[model samples]
Target chain A: MNNDHNEFMWLDEHHEVSLDEIIQLSGLTHDELHRLVENGALIPNNPTDDSWRFNSHYLVSILTLSRLKHDFELESDSLALTLVFLERIRTLEVQLQRSQHTNSAPTIDE
Target chain B: MKFKDYYEILGVARTASNDEIKKAYRKLAHQYHPDVSKDPAGEEKFKEVAEAYSTLKDAEKRAAYDQLGKHASGQEFKPPPDWSSQQGFQEYTFDDIDLSDLFAGFAKGKGRTHQSGRDRPIPGQDYELSAQISLEDAFRGTTLDLGFTVPEYDIQGQLKSVPHAFKARIPKGVTNNQKMLLRGKGGKGFHGGHDGNLYLNISFVPHRLFRVIDNDLYIDLPLTPWEATLGTTIKVPTLEGAVNLKIPAGTSSGQKLRIAKRGMPKHNQEFGDLFAVTKIIVPTTLSDQERVLLQQLADASTFNPRHHFE
Candidate 1:
């Protein structure tokens, strides 16, 4: 194996995962996934195609929703709403963090 | 391994009913869910609660655990020699629980069952780690060397984490909190199973000169009073290299000058814009000629900056 510190393989957002892979990773059944897609909770990259493809970012959301559904026994509609609320919270948090940093003095830490 | 009291962790009775235990687990899970919780140790607490619930919720596992006797939490104890053979617990998949020190001991050759002619394959556990990168590095893709201590099972079935080092390239246009998955880079599988993936959570280190807002970049460009009033072309540093930026005449302090397509690189080679925010600076110490000229200018010019107030 090349152990060089500088040598690396670049990864990007384009590493699309298939529907079967998402199912395996998230432990969601075909029906559950279809429900999510119907509710606009899970969006495939190409919605028109028979085989669904999703960006890697959806993996985290799918996994989290699966866990929440398992733990809380939440219905599909409730799960969809919860996912949207959670995403909104995350966006607001990021905005708050940016505003905080902007207001402070920029210090260089060596 | 140190013993963990499941009932005590959940603040429930030793003889708590299954329904009661489930209720307690749900309450605690809601309180400490890593994504929603604000507590600093919420993730760790969440994992502990999950482990406790996984064992206690299952009737067989709970019975086996009760057979171990009432040991205090954190009390080190070893299982009986025949414990593995007696338990016959279901093979816990990686998705069920994290391989903590306690679970590592419990998982030792206890759940495997021969089927037809071959052993069943158990997929490895997914691992997560946060990585810090510079803003500049995120703009222009860079490679990083990361050291990880990963768990492996010895011949004796004892779990140990050995030090491993690997390099990964962070692609350009990676935003903060974005995760990159390295497939088959996590825990080793059992019985020729596929390895799990490594999820890297990216966090950008604070940059000295630039503040990244989404894909856009902002930098403070300090200019002299004269430079602000009378525009000049000045060299500005970017991630790629320095480029000359033209400041319009009569440019005021705090005015933002845009340089198109000079910011962070996005997917498909698209670029964000960079904004140079102007800051007017004055010399702290004035020479005799400079002071005489300023005094002359003060008497000569009839410009009032606070005309609105007047």
Candidate 2:
């Protein structure tokens, strides 16, 4: 079926996900969630606000964390530590892509 | 249905204690988790391990599974006639009932139930997919025919995959791997629950004319020896079209001539600069006339490229 949407928003800096929204998205309990944050998996842009929100990119990270938590019986703190390395690997892959020269230019006929 | 030996799957003894089962499960899970493991069969192996563990980890589910008479691995078997009389399972046709689903029903007794699983509403699942567009399309922000399988809940709360196709207007200035979240366009939520998001990870197809680094574009501009020395204005192809670029006198190979606002669009409606890297090309074969002219120039001109070595 054609489930077309005329408008869409990017999950960039402009779009932020609220704390409640993240908890719902991640399926982590409050205690587990707090441990994850305390272990440095998430940092809110506004920590003072009751409705502190996260950058939307963290949605991918949190979702990945959720899967890791479910698949492995590790504590949230340990999972958050693993998340740090995984995110690094992802960033390194992108950086690696940038460094390589594909040389896809067409040949000029003499 | 074919029977699966949970103990055999985990490589644990049937008489293994809870701690022993937990230890076995952890080792196998670590090795088979799709995210961590590099094995080709990791995902399927993980699912099998997880499924087996889910049933065995709980006291009630394990006991209920033990109620069923054990059979050899992969042996075809049906549930006992009086299984429906047991707790959690109603008197339903056993012809199509999966063993995992049956045990999952038993485990739900003291655990989470799908009906009451949400004290707070859970958002629907978000989908992430990649779309490859041309550099020109990325510069102009084109619409693409995008599609994904939407995970929806049926009337009985069972999950189903509904294939969905739609036109998506990819915004300009989105770099490779930049994620765009289409709000409420992901998997549909369960009864009155919040809708999920659709994440589109943008990637550009390799362009023949341009090499993109961030917002900027790089193009190789091949120049003749005369053009390099005489300083000629040549048309350089850009994403928009061709623009005349000045090749200054004594231009060297690998020197970049920049064109303003001719690259990919960026924040604040500003465009990045396009760089034309100069490459001095010489004729592979020289005719007699060309050879004589070149010989005369070689004899007259005293430009030594190997001056550094000297």
**Candidate No. with top TM-score:** 1
Per-residue C-alpha lDDT of model 1 across residues B171-217, encoded as one tens digit per residue: 78777667766667777776677776677888889888887776777
Residue B80's lDDT within candidate 1 is 60
Model 1, runs deviating above 4 Å: A1-16, A71-73, A90-110, B89-110, B114-118, B147-165, B282-310
- Interface RMSD to the true structure, each candidate: 9.7, 7.8
Which fraction of the native contacts appears in each prediction? 0.07, 0.37
Docking class of 1: incorrect
Give the range where candidate 1 chain A is weakest over 10 consecutive residues by summed lDDT: A1-10
Native contacts recovered by candidate 2, as a share? 0.37
lDDT of each: 0.72, 0.73
Chain A TM-scores, per candidate, are 0.67, 0.70
Determine which window of 10 residues in candidate 2 chain B has minimal summed lDDT.
B105-114
